[model samples]
Target: MNEFLIKSGIAKGEGNWYSRLTSSLYERIVWQKLNNPLGYIALALPSLLIAYIVSKMGFAIGVVILALIIGLPLTFAAMFYLKFGISLIIVLSFFLLGVKRFVGDVQLGLLMDFLIAVMIFGLIVRQVQERDWSFANNPISKIILVWVIYNLLQGGNPSAESFLAWVYTVRSFAGIMAMYFLLVYAIRSEKDIYFLIKVWIGLTLLGTIWGYVQEHIGFLPFEMAWIMATPERYALLFQAGTFRKFSFFSDPLVYGILLAFTSLLCFVLATGPFSKPKKIFLLAAGMFMMVGMLYSGTRAAFILPVAGLLFYGILTLKKQVIIAMFFAALVLGVVANVPSSNPNIVRLQSAFNPTEDASYKVRMRNQAFIRPFIYTHPLGGGLGSVGEWGKKFSPWSPLANFPPDSGFVRIAVEGGWLGLLIYSALLYTVFHVGIKNYLLLKNPKLKVVSLGMLLVLFSLTLANYPQEAIGQYPISLLFFVAIAILNLSVKFDRKPELLHA
Candidate 1:
């Protein structure tokens, strides 16, 4: 068995950690079990129990068991490898909620929280071995720490209506922030950043393709079933005589914002120091993503890329940027004027003409009404005092029925005006550092990459004004990762040796 492990390259050398661990595991599990009757019975018991359960419960239970068996290796891989874990979390974020379409009601979203917790543990173990923590010593890390502390303090908010609501909401509030520090610590080289960007862009392209299919072909049967399961959902989605395209995300809002911001990122990266083939692909992907964003029928999404472009143009102040912005404005003007009864086009046009939108007016009214309550409550209503948490945990409260449509509004209501002030400071610092980093970077490629991330962040920031943008799964995860990259790009620029650090 030891010889086989060495031959198979599982054990690099005789006295290494891998060799001893694998050799010991093999001997104890296979060799010792074979020589002892009780050991053989112990191994057989698992198979016998599995067979009995299958026989009694049927194929579904057997299938579940098989899935768990398969998932065990994947889970362990994530636990041991930080990069693999981050990539897995991002991939799962894209489809975790969508899985409910086929699987029925289940706490699948919690899987993200679980993965984050495991990765945090893995990070701690790795830190113990390495004994170096300087990677996270940056302004980005400091602000994120401040944000996490504030969220955790929400549990003690005297005005909090329900402690249970805090429990449910704080997981995302303070918990997912762990990924930022993990990423800052784990990312040692430019290649790591490239790998992460590739994973993000590749999955985003797949989502764009899926959204296109749902727009032209139609949703899958299960997706349709999921949409029609609730009347309010069906009504919300089935807009303008067609259902909005959510792709693999939880809702059209999340899907559209993702496509919009990622498309902006792609377009910005196209101008980076890359081969012509890569540039062409980025341009093509950006177009497809724009199409997907339009199909989502989300007015908020319609403005994100436009906002991103404006931000990019301001930061660069180049002739190419001026030309790009002109063309963008021209294209949007044409779309707004081209007399089209199509709902998607109409929705896109309406984004530019917000004053005419009834929903926009309603959102404004809600924000106005909530302004007084937010001002009175310094700590806000607590993390989960609004949205579904409020509806479930404190249904009788006025805030329960109130709809905080925007991310900023939700934060203001839940965290209070003071919390909102701190959150806003965090946002301001992110952009302040991001812009400063982008300006200081002398490397062209690093500059473009930093600019791309900043633009994406800018789009998300704009999106939060109309939708709960960064509070969702993939967006929240990706947002922190982008910040980490942006903060590190300047370091890479300053010392090229850090590119391979």
Candidate 2:
């Protein structure tokens, strides 16, 4: 039998073409087994365990023990399951629950749910696939991996405090991944994209109405009780006798971000791809989104829509609008910087001047205080080591008071300057690819979409300097999808006409 096998080429160098082919096929099967289903499962297990443990423990000592038990498995899993949807349901469930629980005192529960969703999604993706795995292959799956890797490398420690911080990072990553997957995978063609955009527009309109009610009617649904419970947090909006909008999201910031993005999408559809009726509808949606943005009172959120319009104008035949928007931006900047006797106007003015601004000074002071430790721990204070994580892990550290405000700073503090550089490079690459594709693509609609996406990234980059918006779910997922879509669109440059709506 051994001689026959050797002679057959399946054994060594012996046999015919058939034997060689069989050997090749066998090798392929083995490789596939190592790379596919089995490998995927192995990588996802640790993240699953981490998700479960963190859900129960709130990133306490239990997470450390769990990480210790499953760390190697997680490492292996990260290598294999690079694009799986292991955490979709978990995150959606958490977000839905958060929406429901926001009315009550379940902020912690909301936080836990969000974290669990993020952890599961992030780890499974990291462990399973190769680095090149992306949305064209499976936008949702690849984004999940991105989220996991981002959260995992965020800090060094595997302790409870770090774990809790990980939860937030993970949730943000997972949520956005879910949305992108739903958008790209479920929506097969342009019509589907249109339908989904309409749905989003409708949702935004409804959310605006709901927000108005919350502000005016004194009717608090069970879903929004948590916001009501946090009187201190909600008091400013409520007391101002202005509309305190929540827009089917957890907070004004989140609501404003979603509204801004959706509005930009509407603007893209209006100006680039659709029929006249569609454009009209989109215009209406854009108007509503603008209203939502204003009511949400997120000054930072204002930049996205305005920036998107500027980009759209620059790219399209809207030269007059482009010039108008440029002057408008300049005027706004000037007005926002003008010191005035009016307190509200002065406050708005100060927002444009980060140097003398109270909030800017606070951020700078925090950065100053944390610089020494960051210098010493160049590899990062260790995952979840400072700020919120530090408060949980190393409460003694002087840097604990520095909230993880900036996503860039968060990465710098956790992974050190090296990690921040990598992140920055990745972001730059996204913008670069987006701009190149936008300029090259013949499809006017896609070009607008690409531009809008680029604006999202640019806005997030700016926002991250003052706040931790980049890693948050939905936003992060959107960022990656935008990048992926732009990257995929680049392939059509030679045949731009083929990509037109």
Candidate 3:
């Protein structure tokens, strides 16, 4: 019976009759035209006519028509090609919120949610067709599942101030996390990994260049308008007699921390068995990123690379690594001590002297005040009881106004001490998996990539303590991708020949 169904094209798979019908129509209508020069003229005439008509209608109508003409097919293509979807997620993370400067207060995050959902649906379709889910059955994936489950269960917490807040927060916490499985499933080859890394580094270089422009030249008119839209935002961004450059990210903290961690990845990758020109490029990019971090004026960003390198050095336990660490430390020490009037340098120095900073002291006080509540409630005030959701949905609640400055603190406040413990275990498992893979991998290239990934993970983990490093837009997405890549590195080690291929 099964064989008969398969042969008859009645099976519930990609080779079914419905799929064949769609494929035939798509080929005849789209592919043939796209592939043939004569077909191009046939298609372009109608498209040009529609474009002319849309232009006559009005600007907004024309824009909508243009978007539909482009976006619909691209969306369908992304759904079909999970790699393209994943790549879109990565690219958008860098510039999605930045779009607010041009478009005004649109709910762009919903678009991200839609993209992730599409990717997950694509994964499901692939799994159904292939009958294989083993790629996503790794330790990192399991822990992410556990974390998502915990966050989902938060909606039922009786102490939760608003179910709507849970609805909002869980979209990010549980919904966005599904990307981890999608990424793990999609990244099946070494080439795919390298392509994604190139995308990441290329975007980072652009961000750094924009940041340099902002520092030396100035904010473009639209960016200035966006900055001045809110007085609080203006005050926060404009510090120490100059505006802190955020590049393409939402804020300086996100921009600076991203650069700090990715620069560590760059430097680590340069140490791989690659060609001299590639190594030089990696080193140059890493230096550019570090310089960009300085321009961000985010004190939390300053310590991350140092800590990441120290972790890497200890893990390697090589004489040369020790020597390198010594020189890096000496440079940092001189920079910290040889005080300059430059605000960027002063901010850098303050990162090392956290106790002396007014903001640091305030954060400490807030944590102390919030600690007793965490101790009292096993599940704390519940998810979304603090931070942006709290302010939006439960403005009257005391916790609503509370600033859980650190990611850990936010977790503790929302999920309580028990939740914090679970979150911590997840972090520990990621590190354990990454370190185990790095130590066990035999291929030199795989080892280098795995080590670079692990160091970036370590840096983000540490940064989460001082800033909400892993919870923001691109950073959060990148954090999961890094873990997926860490697990993937080990998988690639089994097929070392593929590295060259």
Cα RMSDs of all predictions?
Answer: 4.8, 13.1, 6.2
Number of clashes found in candidate 2:
37
**Candidates 2 and 3 compared by TM-score, better number:** 3
For residues 1-501, write the lDDT of model 1, one tens digit per residue: 667877966555457787778766666666676566656787799999999999999989998899799777878888899888888988988888878667888888777788788888888888899988888788878888998899998899998889999999887665578888888877777888888999999999988889989988998889988998889999999988988999988899888999999998999999999999999999999998988998889999998887888888799899988898999899989989898989999888899999999999999999889888988888898889988999999998888888888899999999898888988999999999999998999988888999999988888888888888988878998998899999888877877876752
Rank candidates, lDDT, best first.
1, 3, 2
Against the true structure, candidate 3 reaches a TM-score of 0.90
lDDT of 3 by residue, 1-501 (tens): 556646765443457677877655555555464666656777799788877887788677877777788878878877899899889888988898888657888888887888788777777787788999888687777877888888889999988989999999888776568888888888878888888888988988888999999999999898898889889999999988889999878989999998998899899999999899999999999999999999999888899988987998888999999998999999999988896999999899989989999999999999999989999998878888998889999999999999887999999999988899988999989989889999999988878988998888888889899888988878898888888888898888888666742
Task: Predict model 3's lDDT versus the native.
Answer: 0.86
Candidate 2 to truth, TM: 0.64
User: Residue-wise lDDT of candidate 2 within 363-430, one digit each (tens)?
Assistant: 78878877776677656655555565567755876556667667778778876776666666666656
Point out where model 2 deviates above 4 Å. Answer: 1-200, 218-225, 228-244, 309-318, 326-350, 353-356, 386-389, 491-501
**How far out, in Å, is residue 333 in model 1?**
1.9
- Clash counts for the predictions, in order: 1, 37, 0
What are the lDDT scores of the predictions, listed in order? Answer: 0.87, 0.58, 0.86
